[model samples]
Target: MTSTSDLWTIRPAQARDTDILADIYLRVRRTTFLWVDPGKFHSEDFVGQTPGERVFVCEDRNGTIAGFMTLWEPDDFIHMLYILPEFQGRGAGKALLAALPEWPNRRYRLKCLVKNTRAIAFYRSLGFAIIGDGSSPEGDYKDMQLSGN
Candidate 1:
């Protein structure tokens, strides 16, 4: 599905977008996950995480990519959502989430690292609630779910 707003255009990711997407993924993870070893993140990690997932890219009015989100549709799981630091509060992330094909009508799930308070707050503001908690190699994370209203 594709969606456009004054600030962002969200569309299905294309093969040509992979490189920039990977770069954003690597950079965002390294900076956002301060508790993790930044050295362990690589562009290849984006490739590995995205296979079999439905991916979408968010671009600005200038056509510059601001972020991307990957969804495991079968489970309504939002596997990843990362906006560049510069684009974080400009509604790119919200646009990407709304672009989901089943958005607002189906439940969605995602895990946010507990220490990533900023992200957790963002999710919470969108009606997500912690359903569980677990530890991953990166750190402890909260399993959050946003149910259809």
Candidate 2:
């Protein structure tokens, strides 16, 4: 499905968009996950990790891809949502979330690294609450969930 929010256009990931999306994935992770070893994240990791998951990409008014999100349908898990640093704070993440099928009527869950306070706050603003906490190889994390409307 296609969705538009302000100047951002959100749509399903097309085959042609994979390379750019993977690059964004690598770049965002390297920059955002500062506590993790940057070398551990590779562009190909996006391709490998996203199989069987539904993926979507958001583009700016000029048609440049600015971010992407991935969802594991079976469990309603928001596996990843990343926007290019240059395009952040424009509601691309929220647009991507809304583009999900049956959004706001379907529960969602995601793990946010405890150190990423900005992300935690963002999620909280979207109505996600920390339901549990745990540690990952990168650092401690909080398991957050948002109930359906």
Candidate 3:
């Protein structure tokens, strides 16, 4: 997708944002993860994400942290996509999800808690298909895919 006006400026995360991101992750851990997350993660546990993962945060015009989403490369896994409850429906989730797939891979996949019907519907609305199921040692979440392939 071509860059929009950057109404929400998107930038590469820095060390400073790490604390903020981790905190947000903690605050909304359940809203996003949905699976059997062990508990609130330590800030340091969020350091690198994964080798090919790309994480981004969105700040409203006022500069408050709104939310964040992550995409893992090659597979373009929808690692996380969440907007603060206060920021929900304002397009933060859509924006962050849209911003992923800079290279536009053929197959994209993500997992959502089996109980989060809302999330499942949202993903379906965006054209993802439930392909399989996955267990994270945490629990089983429905695996979804949208493959340009």
Candidate 4:
């Protein structure tokens, strides 16, 4: 597998990418949510929500799907971000984030599992601040937001 920092392109997802994206989503979720119910992966719910948001995919030089993210542009909410385990820490997440269309005076917000310290740290490094906390069927989570500035 290529490093996430290696040459990769970000593009709008297409119907053809459904399976690949699903696989990445499941794999990443299972790995990250071990503290929760692994059997409740909810792969369908994850894939089903893609159509409602702006989905972007990160592809490697070989055209392999490495990761993906979903953004609700209207609300400036980052719905999901998942990178294959092999591709994590390779800058794929950062690249996917960079691909989000920029808007003036728009703050972005997202909820991340509280147990996902690495992801929380990553978001914090990108200037996101913890604003609150919440709970879901999966587990406890922290609300994080990034300033428009």
Candidate 5:
């Protein structure tokens, strides 16, 4: 497996990927939630949450999981979009989002902790617009939506 930025592949996650996905989830969360208590970062709940969502993983040409995105398709909401810190800014996140099934005239939404400026900028770069604000266990969050064309 030899993947350049453009050569990475996206595919539906498999049962075998649960552990890696959970690890990625936790790692990314911990990095993004630095403002929160470190103890609050380790949770097994993410593994349970994976079964109910539509998860897609991006794999490097070497077959390594570089990132993943989980969406609650029926609700038109993206639950998470996490790329390994090393993989960030390399186009993996955009590739994952672009692979989502297109829905004509239907918008997709997600929330990012207001403190996660990097994520906010990344989402904004991808056309997601800030629509509102709210609070979460981690802290203040901003609701963002991407309009369906």
Candidate 6:
């Protein structure tokens, strides 16, 4: 991705950002992890209790929640990275992608639903290469492992 300030600021999520963070939880949750084993993702309780794992809202000039990304360092996997549908392709996600390294791994890993072709391509463009494929806990979902700098 390229560098551009565009329309947002990056910051740690605070307790006050609780509502917005919850929104992220609701918007994300099973939808993205439907292809990962249940054990790899955080438990529902962490949504409100784990502040360190979260990044707050990236608002546009008008102040809307463009989206946010959260990290779970133990496994080198980005727990969640989401941009509201309206905010997609406007640098929000890319900016968040660029920010991932701040969490510490130069080579990070994340799994994506194999059926989400759009996400697969987006991750590929960001230099994520495939490392593996498997089924989720349900044994019904197709998943792909992605790794990149």
For each candidate in turn, the TM-score is: 0.97, 0.96, 0.78, 0.90, 0.90, 0.70
Candidate 4 C-alpha lDDT tens digits along 1-149: 11244578888888898888887888788888888777877667666776679888898889888899899988889999999988889888888887776732357899999889999999999888999999988789999998667
Could you give me the TM-score of model 1 versus the true structure?
0.97
lDDT of the candidates, in the order given: 0.93, 0.92, 0.69, 0.83, 0.84, 0.62
Residue 79 in model 6: shift from native, Å? Answer: 1.4
What are the runs in model 5 whose C-alpha is more than 4 Å off?
A: 1-5, 103-106
Best by TM-score: 1
Q: State the lDDT of candidate 2 residue by residue for 1-149, as single tens digits.
A: 89987788999999999999999999999999998999999889999999999999999999999999999999999999999999999889999999987877777999999999999999999889899999988799999998667
Q: Distance from true position, residue 134, model 3, in Å? A: 1.6
Tens digit per residue, CA lDDT, model 3, 45-113: 556563456777787778787878777776668787766788877777666666665433456789987
Report the C-alpha lDDT of model 1 over 6-109, residue by residue, as the tens digit: 88999999999999999999999999998889999998999998899999999999999999999999899999999999999999999999898767777899
| Model 3 alpha-carbon drift over 4 Å, by segment | 1-7, 30-40, 102-106, 147-149
Superior candidate under lDDT, 1 versus 2: 1
Residue 96 of model 1, lDDT score:
94
Q: List the residue pairs that clash in candidate 3.
A: none
What lDDT tens digits, residue by residue, belong to model 5 across residues 1-149? 22235668988888899888889988888887889876786657577766679888999889899999998988888898999999998889888887777732457899999999999998887778999999999999999998666
Q: Residue pairs in steric clash, candidate 1? A: none
The alpha-carbon deviation from the true structure for residue 95 of candidate 3, after best TM-score superposition, in angstroms, is 0.4
At residue 104, candidate 6 shows an lDDT of: 29
Residue 89, model 2: Cα distance from true site in angstroms: 0.4
Worst 10 residues of 2 by lDDT: 98-107
> If the candidates were sorted by their lDDT against the true structure, best first, what order would they fall in?
1, 2, 5, 4, 3, 6
